[model samples]
Target: MTAITRLTVLIPEVEPAHWWQCARQNRSGAVIDRALRRHTDAVVRRLRMRS
Candidate 1:
């Protein structure tokens, strides 16, 4: 089981449109969490390629 931490994110005034679309549809935490994980994974991959 994965442990969870409480986060306080201060998003910019103009947030990503898809994020709001998901929120409005009540997709909630799960979708956002996966999106973050995917983004993080991409960053990691880029860094690994450069090293």
Candidate 2:
């Protein structure tokens, strides 16, 4: 099971409105989670490739 954690962020005004739109269509948290996971994985892959 993936352990859920809390994150607090201060984003720009435009971002919140975008997130609200995403929330209306689907789960905003899921959208954010997938984006974060993909970005993190990409960064990790890059670092590993450098080794």
Off by over 4 Å in 2: 1-26, 41-51
Report every candidate's CA lDDT.
0.39, 0.39
Encode model 1's per-residue lDDT on 17-37: one tens digit a residue.
554453443334445555766
The per-residue C-alpha lDDT of model 2 at residue 13 equals 23
In order, how many clashes per candidate? 0, 0
Best by TM-score: 2
Instruction: List, residue by residue over 1-51, the lDDT tens digit for candidate 2.
Output: 999665443222222344346444434444555576666542211111110
Model 1: lDDT equals 0.39
TM-score (all chains, Cα) for each model:
0.27, 0.29
Runs of candidate 1 with Cα error greater than 4 angstroms are: 1-25, 41-51
